[model samples]
Target: MAASIDAYQREIGPTAGQGTESRDGVLSSPLERLSALHRISQSATASLDLDSMLMTVARVVRETLGCDACSVFLFDPSSDTLVLRASIGLNPGAVGRITLPLGAGITGEAALRREVVPVVDAVSHPSYVDYPLLGNQPYRSHVSAPMALRSPDRLIGVINLMTIEQRTFDSEEVAFIETAAGEIAVAIENALLYSETDAELHNRISQLSTLRQMSRLIASTLDLPQVLELVSRQAAELTRGLAVEIYKAHPDDEHPPELLSHYGAGDDVLTDRVRHQVRGMVDEVVGALGTVERSIQVSPGQRVEVMALPMLTGRRAVGAICVYSEKHLGDDPEFHGMLHAFSDSAAIAIENAELYDEARRGWQRTSALLQEMHHRVRNNLQTVAALLSMQARHASSSEATVPLYEAVGRIRSIAAIHDVLSSGSISETTVGVIAKHVTDEASITTLPPDTRISFDVDADDVWVSSREATVLALLINEFVSNAFAHGFSDRSEGRIEINARVSDDVSVVEVKDDGAGVPDGFDPGETSGLGLQIARTLTESDLDGSLSITRRPEGGTAVRVTFRSRRLPEDTIT
Candidate 1:
């Protein structure tokens, strides 16, 4: 008994379902009979433990058949190939090294046909081959038997054996092998049941993980682009998925997966394939309505689960989550469940982002309105000054009251600026209008017809506000008036030129004359009073700027006022 045990254990240890033969005579000892029954009992026991069955098959074939080796080859229905799953004979490497096509070898042929191949002599059989690992042993005769532990109708795999010497197995040995193979089929069926149970546990774990991470991401950000990017990355990482894609559902197209972002381990070619499928045509997206199961068509006809999670901001679908997978993980139930749960978070984040965008747009509109109002206010003030002018002129006595008259002219010049600003659209304006009006109003054109004076305007029309317009216009009037009063008193050739130009976001207004220059070291802020004080106040306070009085290269003093224009900085101010 002990010797038989040693032979079975040592020889079958390396043979994985390897087929061997037993003696032709019946089992003479009670222990031998006992071992055969134990083999059948292990096979008959109903358990979903496929691994335990493989181990039992290896041990039983060696002990009962009294063979050197045994091996089990299971038929994978998807491929129709006999995959060598477990073995007890041959090298440690060769245990899983071999695979036989269905109907290709002795074991494969037997499994494919669900028949028994009992070879009485090894050399006579056509299907037998000299497996290298068993060359050192005295293998001669063998048997191949088919068994199905999964679907009873389908042959699961084949059980094979090899013997030490050339011999034929009798009726008793054949019956024992047949009964043993049937028991193995039962073991296989049990193992598969266990696989399904395990697979379910894994799916539940995965679904929970996805829900947790998705919650944090949807709450963290209001930026639409950023949120989309994060969603793609998180889905891939959490699921250990082959690929992940996020799509935005638009009005024109249903499936236009606005590939917000993606992350994965594959190459650019592979990732690009995912990009195309998620953004599939509109018909495809609409087809996803109410219908649960969907798949994105990939380059190699791979079936990736297409999940449509409409990023519902209110009732409409603002976007969707188009998830994909290259590998068919049997986690479909959990994957579908999680997809539905995460839709709420996705919708909330999208809503928040859209609201923030609307608020920003409103703020901009209000700012434009305020700027327009300021421009008009400034223009209206200038117009009031103009009305005062007509009144002052009718009230004036003569050139004898020239100082009083001069004061009124200055007042009315500023008044004209306020009127222009008030009448026109003030937000978009030009100070040049004010400058031209001032020089024209204070010139000989308006003075007595005998004391002739002409105005020369230069430079482009520099557009500015009615506020800046009034300040700059009044200053020009004062400076030009002073030149006419003092320097051009007994004029040979007198001309006042007002030039306004803009540079480096600043507006420059220059008043020049071909008369006597300013007194040695004269500052308009210091010397020219009443009008000058007002001019200084208008420049520094009203315009929030500066005034420089310089001698023109041609002779007269040019009063240059530099100031800021709210709209001037932007070439296209609305």
Candidate 2:
């Protein structure tokens, strides 16, 4: 311990104990507390709990001096005042005057000069003010030292050694008090970190809870105004804002946006109004104004200028939440982060509500259109089937009769699609129905009953509007009929796999055959069949996709077609 202090003395200059009278017999309490503080100082571990660390420092001060009053004052460097943070054995009323200046008293003078002051008589000192601790009794001896453990080298507070006795506080006692002062500074730092950690954790939990509740509320309701209002109110409360206001934008005049839904304008009306008046601000600062998700805080003079957070619905900026106050209530990095979390929670709810409203309207319109479409398509295909039956009856040769019967079978396959579409509440049917219909018509069912064709679908039910769905169904039918004609001609045991999935707004369908693969010199586009040509036209130009054919690694030909979605990619694929 002595050797450590000797090394510290060289770096910090010799202690006040270097040359002074030592008392042989004295109170052991001061030395004992000093020894305990020495052991704590030797440690290099970090503390995260602020209250416990600050309370421990106060305990050491009370035990060391054996005094009835001890308090720790930390300097708020921004506020530039010695704030009375933690106290022991001191009345709450006495804490206000606990804050002292740079050279006001014995403690202040020691801090200002960056040295220890050991005054045997307080009456002799010019700066000795009557502290509330001594009551009406005169103060005899006092020892004080400046705190310098923390960075930015300013006096945090002073640790004062007070005794009512007239005996001097010798260099030995002064040395112990000065080292104790440094340890108090570290305790102050740890306490500040603990306070920050607690506030951050609390804000994050509140944000997550608000998002969960908002999700449930939006899912069950269709009222647009109510959805907007709930998002704004919850955002304000979650962030602990002074006030929150929201705006809803219009489609045509989105260049100069409109206010949609707003709450809490009493705190700052100007800030609530400034979001729409952002033409100049956006041009001068932050450049782009297309979509905003970040928060902005501007202070003008002593008052807060604005605390603005943007709310986005989908890729567009539908609205924003603005909070205002007369004073700079929240002016830190952590506070700004909490505001951003609040905005994120609100925006997601707004987007979900908008999407739900759209889906409800889409299904109602599409269901009615599909029923009409099924009636018209069934009539047209039956007309073509009746003409094919007429052609089969007029044919003279057996060879010609076989081709006429094949044409009539294709017409029946088209008629079966309307049956599936008209049977359910859904306007669309699976690719499974279309594939199974074509294979059955082409007499691929002549094989054993156990042999099956499988449809391996990996995507959600993608609702294609009328024309697109019909074209895609017919396109898949042509490919399967062609596969049955040549590839599975002599195979009694076989499997056909139809795989479909959606990726990045593109829905892909891959039809693979486990039987004989594509022949050596056969190109699909070179076929004279009108069925293959129609499939190629719909897959390329109509569906906005490309067709690919590959031999599978396990001896099969896979026909892959990828098509784009009409809408943007979202949580729901369709």
Candidate 3:
């Protein structure tokens, strides 16, 4: 066994030593050793994975030091034991499974005393502990170094190197090993710091993601119950599956709280004892206008801790939510702050839902009252038109009948305003429908039986404020009435065309007739007729527009009006 061990050790010893020497066979200078240490440091600290980093450090150090065997052990303060983490020549299976107390073996003593242990003959050293599983031939020379990483030199772990030759390690070699130990300490500390920072960064990212999700879910709907349920579910997720309940605080403190939503675990956690305890906490939170926390024993052996946050809108407390956890969450300020943020979101959601509900109800009431007012106004206008018709029948003169007919036409024009409003929203009205109704109504009232008049209306469906639509309708009525009465009076048959369009942010209406042209040199503002005067007044004063009459080249008159198109604001009336 000893001969075979010699052969095995010699094979590995030379192969490992090759990493530390130049091809020229000169001993490695101090500069070369320092360069090797730099390379080893880079490889060891390259990964944040501590296990892999420590393994790389062990392998690199053994090869750099020209040793046949190496082992790395980490100290666990909780267990008070040094655990073998990585090794080269020792039983590979012993790594991670073998543990030694703080002062049990040479590695342990080195860790306990924060010093180096060197043995020329491991079999003769009183501090050596035998591992029968790690081959029969004992390595003759050994060196152990404790890894210290702080000012007081905190011992974190130990590294051991073994050789087959019964030779004492010179001071220079021992110093090199110590240098390697320093590199290992820095690598281990860097990996642990990186691991902690990565964990914290990931946790913050997850929290931000949860906040975004909660905002989306809460803003998705105006339904009160659905919002509460979503808040409960999100609160549960934020607390890592803790039981959550949302309660709406009644305006009267005497009234018991109304449960809005509950999620996670079950109701058994909310037994009578727990419910009563949580109620008191909630009241205190609402009364104090802040958060409250307490722990309670629900059953003989079961205890639940709760954190309650008041949902506040401005300065008023609207409701509160309780998070129940098996572990105490009161002492954690981070968790408390998270709960407060969630509660604020819930409050805004509740306030918005309530406002929406109130607005809907108010709109319904206002709509009903407006409909009734429009119905009464339309009936009164129709009654006035009917009275004028009766009076026109009673009079047997053309002059009397003409004025009565014009009066009836004007009344019908005003009635058309209410007709449009009653059918849809009162805030906005369409111009096309009013134009068609007025033209059709005027043709019926003004055209004589002997004179066949064809009335055609072409108008775009332009939307405008209701006040603007009424003015435009009156102007349309006067223009269409004049076209029939005077423009086509001399002809036995004629055609009247009304065209309305929207262009360049302006509304254009053109009324043309195929009849005798306007009297030569006659001006619209100077016309002695009331109908022409009314049309001009409406166009300039109310509609903020201009009116012009030009004789068509085809022996007719064309009346054109242009006005700025006033459009309603989006989502205001619709």
Q: Return the TM-score for candidate 2, rounded to 2 decimals.
A: 0.49
TM-scores, in order shown?
0.53, 0.49, 0.66
lDDT of 2 by residue, 1-574 (tens): 3343234234433222223343333434666655766644533124556545554565555454453234555565675556555554434344445666667777678877888888777778898786544241333666676767657665666655444345565466567667777776665555566678788787667767776777677566656678878877886676555555565445565364445666665424445445544433332222332323323343343333345566654455555565544444455666566565556656666777677778867876776687668767877887887787787779998678756665666666666676556655444554555555545654432233444555444333554533555666666666665556555766755567765666676777778777678765557677767766777888888888887766666876788888885643332323
- Models ranked on TM-score: 3, 1, 2
**lDDT per residue (tens digit) for residues 1-574 in model 1:** 3344345457545432234233534465657766776755665463456666676667566656666667777777887887776665445455556767877767777877777787867666787665564331345676888886544476777888766566576666666677667777766766776688788677667667767766776677677778766677766655566665555556665234455655564554345664555555323544444213356555575556654455555456555655555544345655655665666566676667667667757755665565566456546644654555555566646643565556656666765665565455544456567767776777632355556667777654688754566666678778877777766877745777778888777878888887888766777756656767877888888888898887777788878888877764454322
TM-score top scorer? 3
lDDT of every model, 2 decimals: 0.64, 0.59, 0.78
Alpha carbon lDDT at 43, candidate 2: 34
Question: Model 2 clash pairs?
Answer: 50-191, 247-260, 248-260
RMSD of 1: 12.7
Count of backbone collisions in candidate 1: 41
